[model samples]
Target: MSRKRSRLSSEEEMSSKLSDGGCGEGQNGSETSITSATSQAPIDALQSLRQAAPYSTEPEAIAERERCHYGRIPRAAALAGTAHRKVRVYSDGIYDMFHQGHARQLQQAKTVFPNVYLIVGVCSDSLTHSRKGRTVMTEDERYEAVRHCRYVDEVVRDAPWEYDEEFLEKHKIDFVAHDDIPYTTEDCEDTYALIKAKDMFVATQRTEGVSTSDIVARIVRDYDIYVRRNLARGYSAKELNVGFLNEKKFRLQNKMDDLKEKGKKVMTNIGEKRVDILTKWEEKSRELIDAFLLLFGPDGRLSNIWNESKGRLMQALSQPPSPRGSPPPGENGDSHSPVHSRSSVSPPPPKSRRYETLYEAQAGNWMHRALNVLATRKRPHSGS
Candidate 1:
């Protein structure tokens, strides 16, 4: 009877401990089973999310789920649920020039599972160039870009072009996430056939209207414009890989574009007032013409004054000279006093020539007197 009583006490103690959430080696199996049972609702919710259409717009489902659940939506419930370890997701890409598209793909992969360890794989430059053409960024740069993403947890460099069982097992990847579109290569129809066959592929929606190829195409389309813009921003022609002629051409084009833009702005500012501006310009031009005419035109004040002076000069030239002092009382042609004869038909000699002739005559008279004195002194000296 004591043994039975001790056995009952032991059993009761175990049951009490289990009920109080006690953990022990013996109770671990039972605890796991109970946890699984309790996690069914969240698991079901996650399964529903997965099965739902990618672009479903039905708000009733969300409303119903919100009404039923009280806590945050469980992440990675399909594989590990919220109570288990996080699901490991692997996504591979060239991821060159890390744009919004790459970011969105990683984001979708991250949130597709509530708790996720996102591992991004970047391909090597040689592999990419051999199979997928050249990439804008080098392998190391691409790896660093993916590593710094907020959604990425790990970065794998020189990732394989195609996934195999060994690679997946090595990474312990739970799901290989990418776009739904099949990636075809020369050797095979789809590179991800193995992953898809193993049911490890998770499809992420591709963001429309943007892609790396599209971005590259745009750059190619506006090649000159971008080069010119970089040059304007202090980049050199050699850095832009432009030749001398092309650089000059691009600069000229840029100048022309700038001129066009300036002209457009000027016209926009002028708007509907161009006619008024022309009219004002015409008024200013007319005022200038009037001022010019007033100053120096054929009928201007200066022209009139010149015409009057010319008439006075012609009248003075046409008139006869007045006689001076009535020719000094009957001296006519032989007058010693310098005077004009009223009776003479010809005009009198000028004062300058008259004074010159008078000086010459005085010099001649002095010379004759000297000659006469010399002749008298040396009159043959007859007595001697």
Candidate 2:
């Protein structure tokens, strides 16, 4: 009976160890085992679910078949009233310049459902140029731009210009998101018509007053202005693709603008100082006029002195000069002629015709006689 009780107790102890997470270690070790097993339970279940459905008739199997066949998501599971899953949303565009409008569109696609797996497709450069026009950014740049967007969960390069069933199924796209506007192409009136007909088109609200085309239009409208601005900011003309003549023309215009600004500043300064300048000019002009009158006015001190000097000069000229042969004045020797001796200093030069005092009639005769007298005069003999 003791052996039977011992065996029963051992069995109970073994059952207890199994209950403690199938490990015969301590409580902490048992707890760790429990945690690891709990963590792996979901992964194991997922793996089983994935592996069990090839031949079964379960609902999961049917859904898997549908997904494999048509690449369609269970739309009912992600509806408003039901539990939401990760809805794979697809959007495509040239995405040139990658502005806020593009970001807002991606954001709409991201948040349209409770959880969205946003797959953004950037069209290739060749495709974009062929279908629409040349893009400002390259294909690689556009792809990276879309890839780095916060709303995008994945980025597909070289995306199709138009969507087909093969394209949609390849990307596993549940809904195609874009604006509601009818996008016309050369081959079709509406590019999204098929997606719309298939009930896979999701509309996004476009931001008003902003778009890539609108931005490009603004740049084109102010082309010259932007060019000038960049040039002033030290961008070279060659880099800007400006011809030599255009560069010179733009520089000349900039110089003219600078001159205009300087002239305006100068005029403003002049205007501010005009009253002071006029006041100073009035005071200085009075002093200048007074000095001018003192020097050359008709009744000035200079005129009175000039008249006195003229009288003395005329009196001296009226009398004959002392004979050249006569002894000089202040000499002890007596003069030969009975004419009064004159000052020995040379006479003043004759005035111009405009200021002729009294010799206007005798001027030519007097000049001739004076020339004859000067020619006849001989140098005094010097003793050896």
Candidate No. with top TM-score: 1
Q: lDDT of each structure?
A: 0.73, 0.73
- Lowest lDDT sum, 10 consecutive residues, model 2, at 49-58
User: With candidate 2 superimposed using the best TM-score fit, by how many Å does residue 269's alpha carbon deviate from the native?
Assistant: 8.0
| Cα-based TM-score, every candidate | 0.55, 0.55
Question: Which candidate number has the best lDDT?
Answer: 1
Per-residue lDDT of candidate 2, residues 1-384 (tens digit): 998687557556545665666564555866766655444434433344344212213365345435543445655655552433357788888899999989999989988876665777788988889878888889877876777676775677788878887878666678889999999988999999999998888899998988889999999999888888888889999999999999998888888889999999999999999999999999899899999998899999999999999999988776443334434322222334335334445343344522452344356557767887887776455683
- Candidate 2 clashes between residue pairs 3 or more apart in a chain or in different chains: none
Question: How much is the lDDT of residue 370 in candidate 1?
Answer: 89
Clashing pairs in 1: 75-114, 76-114
